[model samples]
Target: MKTNFNKEWKKDRIGSAHSGENPMVIAKMRSGFAAIGDTQFLPGYCVLLPSKAFGSLEELDFKQRSEYLLDMSLIGEAILKVCNPRRVNYSIYGNTDAYLHAHVFPRYNWEPEERIPYPVWQYSGEKWRNFEYQYSDKDHGKMKEKLSNKIYELMEKAY
Candidate 1:
């Protein structure tokens, strides 16, 4: 499906970060923006969105592509430092959204035994759509702070 970037993301999220309207943004990286995920089913889930919208990774120049991927890793590392999940799952599929972005999902040891050994996609639709897992400033304040701090620290070390 074709996505309306202006209507879906840039209008509500992308520029919101620059204008201080979106609190989910953790840090602005070399080639993109790092932000916490809308859902917290896995707690430390996050996303890496490119600074400039692209249809896919192949659309970016080599350097920008590398930087974007590196930024994704930085986000995973920051999550590892803060949440210490069992493993981090990285995915860059644009099938639904049609934008070049990466998802960083931290898998925990405490997850259901059956789900632990498989990709997060194995989880039910209810798990993904549950309002109970929605991000809230009140509930996720500490996590947001720690993740933001760690991301900044990692970014500084890279410079």
Candidate 2:
């Protein structure tokens, strides 16, 4: 069996430009930052992708590592200002994708699901299962058609 099964990063990409699904994305940092994942319990659970191509912070130079941490801090602050989560959690484990990224999550005071530490994915049993598989263009436009413009404005301010 092949140990180094090189996964195609492009296939599973999640950022706004890549996925073309999530509307919550406000900004994407340069390569030396983090990846794009479900920012956790918050509405804008985001991933701060590493600016460099690799995932090992230890492998990075002093400058690279410092910048990455700075970027993470900035992203976390932005998320808190935008999402207003009760608390924030940062986790960096590249076991699955082996990409350099930070999991930026906002823990709120009130969560709808049962008392557990699992993500919404584990709760829903699938990704984005609360919505339908696909929708017509009309429904797509209608999806955000009702939302106030203030949210987008806030994103601009936060990002």
Candidate 3:
């Protein structure tokens, strides 16, 4: 039977990270986990999920909030380095999932002229939700490796 992957991932992200079940995870940060997005339509899309389950960023203490934002920026920079997008967009919206997480999307200049300047959400529902955009091990492995290496390199330079 096919599994509800997102549900399963959300059930035990920490444990999955420790056990290596969640392949999207790139690195662990002080306040959260950095992971590549399951969808690669935008190339280096990624997310920063809080280590401890929290409803929203408002629930985090000042230090934790700052750390999460910093980690988000780290992921964005890594994507920028590896994907060479024209710009990176950062968004934190907990409307669907209550979990405190942030999305880092890399925007490319090659995108259609009409869609390039707008949010990714403005794309047609089919384009946004197409299963063809789903991650594949063979296709995405190199991207994951490049992003992971860039993230570690950035972390080293920050220290």
Please write out the lDDT profile of model 3 over residues 1-62, one tens digit for every residue.
22235667657775676667776788877777788886778898888878876988999989
Ranking by lDDT: 1, 3, 2
- lDDT by residue for model 2 (66-99), tens: 7667667666665566567776677777887787
Question: TM-score of model 2 relative to the true fold?
Answer: 0.57
Cα distance off (Å), candidate 3, residue 150: 0.7
Looking at model 2, residue 136 earns an lDDT score of 26
Best by TM-score: 1
Best prediction by lDDT: 1
Q: All models: lDDT?
A: 0.83, 0.50, 0.81
- For each candidate in turn, give its C-alpha RMSD to the true structure in angstroms: 4.7, 8.3, 2.6
Candidate 1, residues 38-129, lDDT tens digits: the string is 77899989989788668999999998888888889989999999999988999999898777889999999899898888888789988877
Clashing pairs in 1: none
Worst 10 residues of 3 by lDDT: 1-10
Candidate 3: segments with Cα more than 4 A from true spot:
1-7, 10-15
* Candidate 2 stretches greater than 4 Å from native: 1-25, 28-41, 112-159
Q: Quick one: RMSD of model 1?
A: 4.7
